[model samples]
Target: MSDDSNAAGAVEHREVVVIGGGQAGLSMSWHLTARGIDHVVLERDTLAHEWRDSRWDNFTLVTPNWQCVLPGYPYSGTDPDGFMSRAEVYDWVRAYADMFGPPVREHVEVVSVTQSHGGGFDLETTAGPLRADQVVVAVGGYHVPTIPRFAEKLPHGIEQLHSAEYRNADALPDGGVLVVGTGQSGAQIAEDLHLEGRAVHLATGDAPRVARFYRGRDCVAWLQDMGHYDIPIQQQPGGLGKRENTNHYVTGRGGGRDIDLRRFATEGMSLYGRMVDIVDGTAVFEPTLTRSLDAADAVAESIKDSIDVHIARLGIDAPVEARYRPVWRPEREITELDLRAADIATVIWSVGFRTDYRWLRVGVFDGAGHPCHHRGVTDIAGLYFLGLPWLHTWGSGRFAAIARDAEHLGERIAAGAREKAAA
Candidate 1:
């Protein structure tokens, strides 16, 4: 811990330190305390501020309430069918932190965690410095919005911002709105806007199979009931084994947790296949592919139901039986939104988000701008990472999946601490 920095003098020392105060950071803090380890959590803001601040007003956990619990605590709430709202989840996280009374140094921004001469770390923060024998970086992946470059060429009046910044469709410019990307955020936003009586156009890139709930039942309950939550990741077989580490896929960054895009279509949302170019505020789609995508949605839904069946047979739970729902596709004679024909006020880009680790001057990041690690262990001794998407297992990085990684990493940290103390 450093008392003063940039004064030509600073005190620095700590046995262990965890960077971030979200689920992973809070999880690690609990485990460290369980082992009687002295550590502190350095948070850039109050706990779960991102959940409280960034999420849209109507956003709900795609994973049900049963899956929202953290280690050393259970989610005690009355809403079983009621998907947790953003505020509800944030409150749960804060309560969990307060329960164990983890020492959190809030509002202190960590600039970097450079390796010191002694091989530990010179933790440069806005407030002084902190030296640690071990450090766990739990900064999650949803920090920055990943915006496509093509959007830059659009006219100035056509407003656009990523999903992280979008609160709801009320912020959009008046007219039929054009929503690009068909992943979780895009689909949800398109659905919400269409329901509000706006003429919405969804530009889908690639449509993936999404379950209304995992396996015809609530996905989270199945994970816990079948021990998917506790399954030893090394035992995953076949495609499951291949996808044990989830960072390989380039599809919708948010999968398994978004509303069914097909649902939006069934509910009267206009959908387009692809955006070729924006000509005077009009987005033109490829005619052939545009015609084929609507029919393709049926195949996608079938594939999703198949996965649900498989997941249910894994002994997770009985499969859910529901009415067959169809995908939302744009008609050839669909009504086009003329931003030029009318007033265009705002554009909410429900595209996706990315991780911004540039501030942390560390050597562990890969060329793709992602942290390089094996099971959350970095090559830099004493430096660990957590809550990364698919860090070591299929579920490694998802909110419903992080506890497994947290437990394994916690054991590793605790054993290492014991070894160092014995020395």
Candidate 2:
């Protein structure tokens, strides 16, 4: 779409502009295209670049193959339970674009998105400038790396990398690697490094864990049957604050393995409590190792009990015993892990991400830098967000669940377009 310009040269305009080319952006595009909405997708890199580059070599979706959901393209592969590697995920995203052929512009980095004096946005891009009547910021949550500032206290001799920058164990320097923040990425990366024979030190607080498979079916299978993904945003336990922190401990390797702090503590890897600070070239830690392990085990037991209850209610012939390895409860571990003394040369921070809204110059964002939206509708008429974690459900940020949210946002955008045209 092009607009007749007065002073800013010939400007390209469209009814809608989606800011990312990942699943969220593409899914939004598919919905917009289906409803005859004219829109463009701007990708700073190739499609699914973050999935291609941000994950490690052994990385796979925690959810199953059947959960590979999209607007029009559902998973048609044979093995629905199988997990996809990084390369395979890239292929899946590429195939989606080929099938839909959404209007996508690659390598066009959006430098800034300022509101025009008129309605809509003035987008300054690396490839020049354009404008759009509606803008959907589907850039996802992992736009920026969130490393603790205290990491700067470490001696330069100690190498450090965030989970986004870490590729594999071999890429790290020699000696033990201190992996901080034992969420999904941290737990997975620690396993990766430890499996690679690198001395591993996992520094973390109490993060809950769950057996990948419980009873006779996968844990996700039970979650799906119980309609876990369909739960509303407000009805969820822990309310809104816990929404940002409930990334569970699980992995997709070896037919969905059960992983937790206690399991890692017994794998010959040193486990420490939360890192407090660094003093005199020594990295200090909190004394919560036992507490962390016990807390994780309690959660795991609770999940297992829930699964058992469901199985009994359904009269399913699933096994009474857990199908995987028994959870390993190591002794009360060391509270302090001396980085230099332990010969730890590399520290991989698997401490989650922050939304990079630097390009957004809108007033709709909250004090936390999160957009204020009602199912992707920001207060500003033409601005929206998609692929946000817990935007609508627990699965909003994931590939298996983005399509539903995208479809909702797409309809919203289309309605806005119709209103503009009618006016």
Candidate 3:
């Protein structure tokens, strides 16, 4: 890479530029380097910063360690089925970068990416300007944490934060904790607090749940054997709509297990339906607590049913397992919750995140602001996206399948560079 001073500012030039230095970016870099492509990776923060900082103290990968496959560096840990903790995850990614040195610029933020009139792309960054013949946006969606608008009306004395900001039960103010949303993060975090003996009130959403283990192996192992993870997004049951589906809540903490909100309810963790609004200093919820719980349980059983079919079809010798049954049910609809009366001092919003592509001034986005791409290859020449959920397959956004996606993108990028050179 080289830099030249122009009228606007110092302009660094590269054949290809990659944004974000997480696993996605690093994986892309790995492929690019192997193909002898010259590129620079610009990271807004330190490499693997998300794993190091965003997760809670007790967080672990829902998927087993064996799934962590970068471009070339696969997980070599002894226990393939065991999950890696937050610190271990960070170290793993960092070790990948160290093993194969990528031309990564840490703390250099790419403020904007736009098409250049002279061909290629122009990027405005904290360091200055950059020109690239091709660009790979390795940043996965979920740029901004989403909280309900009515959260502002909550009592000021009650501390509020996004699940991303939550570390542990001790970090929160003493009193009952209200956890909103039942996605993987919310469910696990709620379990984290409940195990710590903190007063926990969980507000559930429409997210599904899955059993951690079934028969004699992890559910994930069964799914993998059944070729569930290998299905392309286009061939998925819901097709592209599957991308919007919330992940089933499960946990890898303490040797991996299922997250049963119903069990939590029986154990004194208050369960309510989705929080709709805060009115008159009171929290209003839909009378869908029972519905949500049933839906989650139903999904979990559906997974087990699929497993049973797979086992029977192959005539495998897996041990027979009993289907899950709801252990507890709501006696009555509890639609209103008074924060003060319930002694709920902390509200953690685990409602998920929103995509922020405001910095991208390209016309490759659709009406929904999602990038218009076919397996990460956008319509616009030399522009691409990587590491999006279901971008090509169920594993597209995850560690298990990123290597394949990155390898494909690397081939596309290299071919594009060759075409440009031939021209």
- Per-candidate TM-score against the hidden true structure: 0.82, 0.95, 0.98
Q: Write the per-residue lDDT of candidate 2 for residues 313-343, one digit (tens) a residue.
A: 9888887783334456545556556678889
Q: In model 2, which range of ten residues has the least summed lDDT?
A: 322-331
Instruction: Candidate 2: give the clashing pairs.
Output: none
Which tens-of-lDDT digit does each residue in 232-335 have in candidate 3?
A: 88898888888889999999999999999989988999999889999877999999999999999999999999999998998999888787888999999799
Name the weakest run of 10 consecutive residues (lDDT summed) in model 3.
1-10
Model 1, 1-423: lDDT tens digits are 333423455556777889999989998898888888878899999887888888777766666565665777866788655567777788888889889898898998999778789767778898877788789999886777877776775667778777777787677666767777766566666666776788776776554433345445544454455555455445755622443222211111133343555556676666666665666665566553344454445544564555566665665555555544554544563333455564545555655676788876778887667777778998877889998765676566666667768888888888777777797
Identify the runs in model 1 with alpha carbons over 4 angstroms from their true place. 1-10, 213-216, 219-263, 266-268, 284-339, 342-344
TM-score of 3: 0.98
Candidates sorted by TM-score, descending order? 3, 2, 1
lDDT of 2 at 38: 82
Candidate 3: regions farther than 4 A off: 2-10
Model 2 scores a TM of 0.95
Q: How many backbone clashes does candidate 1 have?
A: 5
Candidate 2 residue spans exceeding 4 A from truth: 3-8, 322-333
lDDT score, residue 264, model 2? Answer: 60
